[model samples]
Target: MSTLSLPPRLLMGPGPINCYPRVLSAMATQLVGQYDPVMTGYMNEVMALYRRVFNTSNQHTVLIDGTSRAGIEAVLVSALEPGDCVLVPVFGRFGHLLAEICERAGAKVHTIEVPWGEVFDPQQIEEAVQRVRPKLLAIVQGDTSTTMLQPLAQLGEICRRYDVIFYSDATASIGGNAFDTDTWQLDAVSIGLQKCLGGPSGSAPITLSPRYVELVRKRHHVEAGIKDSHHHGASGSRIQSNYFDIPMILDYWGEERLNHHTEAASMLFCARECAITLLDEGKDAVIARHKLAGDAMLAGIQALGLQPFGNLQHKMNNVVGVTIPHDVDGEAIRHTLLHRFNIEIGTSFGPLKGKIWRIGTMGYNARQDAVLHTLQSLETVLRQQRGPITGTPGAGVDAALAVYDENRQ
Candidate 1:
């Protein structure tokens, strides 16, 4: 059999983008025993590192050993008891995902939705919260399917007013966007490293407020295999999923070091390096970089006479959705870019499937060179296709360069 080989494609898609070199290197470091002093020390460091990443002082911050969605599930399932009410505002695909997860967790789910390209206003969410009076207000801070960012600063205060636990999945927007876990009064937040942390998708960094901790801990049950004299069960109903029991996971991560599952050491290293890299660069600097690259990509697409999907004002700083031209075959264009240029962009889901292309400037791919290369290559593919499509030669690259130039000055 031939050796495993894959093309070195430039990932400019919605996520699972290029991992930072340092993160890749970190993952290659040899593993130690799960409970080794060195491994536990790294685990502690990861907890400490993610506190800064999440911008919270909450002692419950830790890593979930799965993708972004696993983090979402762990937070929701642990927090919501059977028949508890949850309010979810849907503006994009991930919003639907939040609602579905809530339903699966046996929560009575209430939903408020807007058009796919538009986000719900704070008042609309507030009105729903006022009417539904949910036990938990769950939402997505950034939904890549529509490339829209829901404004969260106000909703936090609204949840606080109604005495509702505010939980958000910032998987798509955390590192590249402005997320303040403490200032926003968020009760629980989960994020993946792939998007803007410049790492592969496996480890999820999550934070829980003291309020959230107290709520979930009531349902805590020590695994029978690891139960001991000091362990005690809570009065609340036991959490349904064994793997997602946050309280048990917290004990494993906490000073108690009670065994949960074998820690994913390589992923732990990757998460650590991702966080260290971001902090070294500085959070604001990394955000600014994403914003600059995203702006350039936006300018490039518009200069090529492409209309962007969604409300530009509410668009996330890391990804943009371009409306597929009436005459252009979106898939064919994507095919040429992937095969010929070895560069990848994203297609949308749900309401936007085949209607818009999602181009991302995120993590390690969020750079001027990557943006320009994508624009120039896309211009080539568009021009080669036969149709009513028309754009001034080099206009896309020129426009992007102008954005960089202006930023430099």
Candidate 2:
């Protein structure tokens, strides 16, 4: 086999951005047996670390071994029994994903949709909840496909008033945006490390409120293969999927030391380091950094005389969508930026396909230097493709620098 050599790409796409160096290094550390004290110590520390990262005292915070979607599935499957009603407000592609997962888990899914770029108002959701009487309210905090951040601050109270459980998948907007798991009164929340945690996409961090914990524990079933004399079964239905059983996963992480699956040791180390890096830098400081980079990117795109997609007031701080000019070939521009400039941006999904381009400022790449470099490179490629510039030459870079300068003062 040939040596594995790849270009040093600057990932300005929506996710799977460049990971922090410390996280990569942490993954390379020597591994111990799964039951070793050192291994369990790291696991306990990771759970504690993510409690702070998620801004909750849920006491059941843990990492799911697969990608971000695994966290979403685990939460939905564990909470929803057959014929449970769930109301999903669809703003973009991932909202459909939540609804789909609920359906697969045998829920009677009810949905309300706005256009792709806009989000629901709290009153609209309240009306639906009153009419449908769903057992759960499922939503996504940020949908990277449309670069929109749904306003979730009010929905929790609506769910509480109706005795419906509140849950959100914050995979795309956790560290880069304002997410207060406790202050917002969310019963359950799930996130991945790849976006704003400055890590890869193999691990998911999840938190559950005491109310949610009591709900899942009702369906608890210890795997027969691993059950010992002290194990006791609950009267509720046994969870269908062994791997996604939250109670079993909790037992492994809890003082019981029950075995579910062989832990992904490397990914655990990576998850721990991601949380440590974010906490050490301070959560508020990291969010401000993402905001600065996102603001600069927006200013730069506007300076290029290109209109952005969606409502600016509700956009996320980590990604933006730019409208493709009718006269230019969007794919050709992306091709040139990738092959010639060693940069990577994102494309849209579903109804937005071929209509817009998505660019991201997230995690380790959320910095002034990365913003300026991507702006200048995109400006060069656009000028080359369309011929004859519109406004001042190098206006993109200059406008972005002005944003940084203003923030400095």
Candidate 3:
């Protein structure tokens, strides 16, 4: 077979965005033995870095070897015993995913859902938690499916009051949004490098509070070959998946340095570099940058006479959802944008499918030029599709520029 090659294109879509250059370079560095002192040192550093990225002081912060979904499964399977009750609040696709994963883990899952493109009020979630009396409350902080970010601040308080363990999949919103794991009282949180962190999507960085760690340790089972006489099977049922057992994974990452699967060295490096870049830039500053880009993108779409989907105030800082015009073939416009302008935007799924296009300003792409270029290309594609354009030819660009100028002041 011929050598592999890739095209040059801008990814302005929901996730798997361009990686930061430094992260790519770091991933290219030489590999090391998984148990090598140098490797372990880097591992510890990664754990420390992700703690800051997650805005938590949890000692169990570490990387799961697969994608973001792996981290979610690891947390759920390790913490949940068969027949354990889990309360899920579903607003979008990812929230549904959490419930599905919990169900697979043998948890008796109960869900409360809002319409797509809408977020739950804290009261609604509290009321549901009260009714369910669940052992854990699982939710997604942001679901790119409908481009809505559920407010998590008050949910944590409600969970605490109701004596429920709180967990969130922050894969789509972590770095580019306001997420305080400690202050929010989130017991467990998982995130990916591909979103606001500006890295490729293989490694999942996860953190667990002391309470979560204690619970998972109860299910710990060492491999047979490595087990000493003192090691015992879980007091409860063993975790459903060997690969996703958090306590065993932590043993590898923890001071005991017990072996788990061989770590994905390159992805770990990339994840570490991603955290360093975000922390160096200052988390608040990076979030502000995303907000500015999101605002500009929204303003530009509005200027082009397209209505936005969802509650705008509850929209994520990293993505904007715009309605597809009635006369336009949404896929055709997206195709033209990718082929002609080499820019990629996203399409929606489920109820919103074929109805809205999702435009992202996230991670390394959260910049003025990226926002303006996307808006300009979208404007051109819409015009080509014979979609009605209410404003002047360059109105989208003008509107985006106005937002940029305002942000500068």
Candidate 4:
């Protein structure tokens, strides 16, 4: 096989944003044994760093050795038993994903859905929880499919009142938006390094409150080969998937240093550096940067006379969904932007496919230059395609600059 080679293209999409150079550099470092002192130290540091990133004091913060979905599945499979009732509030694609995973875990999944662009009201969720009296509430904090961020603060309280375990998949919104795992009373939260963390996808950093830990521990089971006389079998049925067993994963991460699977060391390094970079910049400041970039993108797109998808008030700070103008072929425009301009934006999924464009301002790409360049290149591509262009040339750039200037004060 030939050595790897790739084209240079700007990723301005909903996820897997360009990694921070520092994170890439970190990942390129030499490897160490999983139980090596230095490796374990780095592991401990990662747990601590992510606690700050999630704004939680939970002692159970650790990286699941897979993608964000792995973390989601681990939590659901460990916490739920067959026929257990799980309530999912579906606002967009990820919401549907949670319900599907829960069902696969043998949960009796009950879902309440809002339109793609809208978020659920706390009262609405409370009403559903009271009616269902579910064992758990699983939801997505942000769904890039519609560029919407569901409000989770009040839902936590509702879950607590109803004695429901609250879990959120914050893979898309964690670093760029407000998420207080402790303050919001979220029992378990899972996140990915790819989105606002400015790292490549692989590691899933998750935090579980003490209550969640206790619940998961009840279902813990040692692997047959690793079992000892002291090791008791799981109180509940063995979690369906051995690889996704959270208790075993936690033992691997904890001081016990028990082996579950070999740690993905490079990805751990990448995830660690991503958290370090965010904390060094200050979480509040990083979130503000994303907000500014998102605002600028929104203003620029509006100046170009394109209406944005979804309710503006509930949109995520990391991405914007813009309506594809009439008479314009969305895929052709996206292809032109990628090949001709060396820039990439995303297309919508499911019901929104071909109807809108998803442009992201996230991680390292959440900068003035990236946002302006995307807008400028898009305008040029639209003009070339003879697509709708209601505003005068350069209006988008001017509007974006105005937002930057205003935010500078």
Candidate 5:
């Protein structure tokens, strides 16, 4: 195999936002066996850290050892019994993803779609629920596909009135937005550290209310052949994968001390550090940081004469979608930004492919320096990709700095 050498790039993309140095250092710490007391101690600490990060007292909070999608899939399969009805309100690609996962899990999925970059009002969802009356409602909180944030503050009350389980994929918003799991009455939530948590992608932090845990418990199962004090008894419905069973995972982390599978210890360290970083920053400050960065980015792009793609009021406070200029090669600009400027921004997916570029100011990168670097690199690349024109780089930076100055007073 060829040896790999990766150059440092300013990640101003939709995710994996330039990891914190402390998180990287934490991940580099010496590893221990999964069952080692020190390792399990760290694991328990990770759970506690995520609970604070999620602003929830739910006892079922834990980590899934995979990307954000893995947590999404696990929740779908574990919650939706076959033939159950699930309502998904789609405004972007990730919303469609929730429907797909629930469908594959055998739930009768019903989707209410709006144009990309738009969010469904709670009334629309309530109207749909009045018609289909789904048993569960699954949605993506902030879809990077359109850089739009779907509001859920009123959604949980609606679901509760109808006795529906409410679930959200908050991978794109967590740590960068104000989210309260208990106040929102979310039955379950799944998030990744990559987007706004300033860490590498691998572990997914998830929290579930007691109601969700109880539902998942119905479908729990035990692995067939393990011989240790860690092995546990089987439940009725036989969860499909031995690896994805949440109850067994809880048992391992709980007093039962059952060994479900080898936890990703290095990832657990990084996950813990990510949560601790958020807590240290103060969640409101973190959200405000993202808001300022996003505002600066949007202003910068607009000053360059590009139109942003999403509803101005509901955009995610970290990522923005800029419409690609007619004569410019969007991918070419992205390539130049990466190779020449050592900057990384992203292209969109599906309906937005080749039409819009997704720029992010997430996590550690959500600051003036990173935002200005992205703007400068973007300006240089856009000029190279499609002839230069006069634009006000200063205008955007000054506008953002003005906010900081005002806040200081």
Candidate 6:
């Protein structure tokens, strides 16, 4: 265990995608006291940094101390009450996850499920809302399991007309695609650093709109002195978990500056750096890079006679689902790539497991070399395993090269 050293893998997988070298460096900086002026200064900057990153003027911008799931839980428990109904438009695995969480929170969960690789239209969601009159409309913008990106813009406007709160988990596609929290009327959105943001897991950036804030603020009465006085008020009902209380989180981020847990300093550092890097490159430019990488990766795979998995038009630009060849052991090929080629890709989950491979070109790894190398390595390994092949592996590289050149020119 002491000698364990992992290779610098080309991470072409679902997520915790390759973090930027700059982010890694920032995480390694010397630690400061949790409440030290310098550390809190950085924390304040983290809020500002992610505000720009999220493209919102939301005053409730802050990071959760846990993974993306923690952020999701925080929003659900904070915004929901017992007996409230929530409409979830399920197109992939993550939507089911949101439904499950809401169910645990005692929400009357209503689901509108589609095929694995499909997404809902605004009309379908409106129909569901018509049926349920849900208090909240929760869905995923991008579901990595199926490589499908459910459109959010139209759903936002529709939900507002229905008096429903809108929440989204953008963990899989936030930085890689076009997202506007304010203009889209999202009540709340949660995202992780592990994907298109180009940083590690263990933290999630969340944004909340003022209307949503006021709605949840109804639940915010926690005073030790008068704890038992208002049994009828919203706060009288204990939140499922104390660790994820958003009113408390808000107090910590707001001028109250109340002490909760000592913040995750290093994670905050890395998140700040990731957002800064995004801003430095410009969000539009970073998205354009992911677009190019996705296109090149798709072109290369198609050149190798493989078909992409999903509705090509609706797929997230950061991840692609590829059909696994008939005679090839998908696991063995992935293992060989990890051991020999020093690259890593992924397979799918649940019903789609082993049927498709998910290759990612997200965050810092969305580049010419990463895309081309993954295609070339996959081709070589498939050939050695006596898997069916097309003309030449070099052709895939050349196709990607042409794309890269075209982009530059």
RMSD (Cα, Å) for all candidates, in order, is: 1.6, 1.8, 1.5, 1.4, 2.8, 1.9
Between candidates 1 and 2, the lDDT winner: 1
Quick one: ranking by lDDT, best first? 1, 2, 4, 3, 6, 5
Model 3: per-residue lDDT, tens digit, 253-318? Answer: 999997779999999999999999999999999999999999999999999999999998899999
Among these predicted structures, which one has the highest lDDT?
A: 1
* Reference-based lDDT, residue 352, model 6: 90
Off by over 4 Å in 3: 220-222, 225-234
Residue-level error in angstroms, candidate 3, position 407: 1.7
Prediction 1 TM-score vs. true: 0.97
List where candidate 2 sits over 4 angstroms from the true fold.
220-222, 225-235, 387-389
Could you tell me how far off, in angstroms, the CA of residue 229 lies in candidate 6 after the best superposition? 8.7
Q: Point out where model 1 deviates above 4 Å.
A: 220-222, 225-235, 387-389
Model 6 regions more than 4 Å off: 1-4, 220-236
The TM-scores of all predictions, comma-separated, are 0.97, 0.97, 0.97, 0.97, 0.94, 0.96
By TM-score, the candidates rank as: 4, 3, 1, 2, 6, 5
Model 4 Cα lDDT, one tens digit per residue, 216-264: 7777465665554232345666667888888878888988988889999
* Candidate 3 steric clashes: 0
Cα shift from native, residue 210, model 4 (Å): 0.9
| Cα lDDT, model 5, residue 407 | 60
Clashing residue pairs, candidate 2? none
Which runs of model 5 end up more than 4 angstroms from their true locations? 1-3, 220-222, 225-236, 387-409
Error of 2 at 92 (Å): 0.4
lDDT scores in order: 0.92, 0.91, 0.91, 0.91, 0.85, 0.88
lDDT tens per residue, model 2, 58-101: 89999989999999999999988889999999999999999999
Task: Using lDDT as the measure, name the better of candidate 2 and candidate 3.
Answer: 2
lDDT by residue (tens digit), candidate 1, 243-281: 998888998999889888999999999999999999999
Which window of ten consecutive residues has the lowest lDDT sum in model 5?
A: 227-236
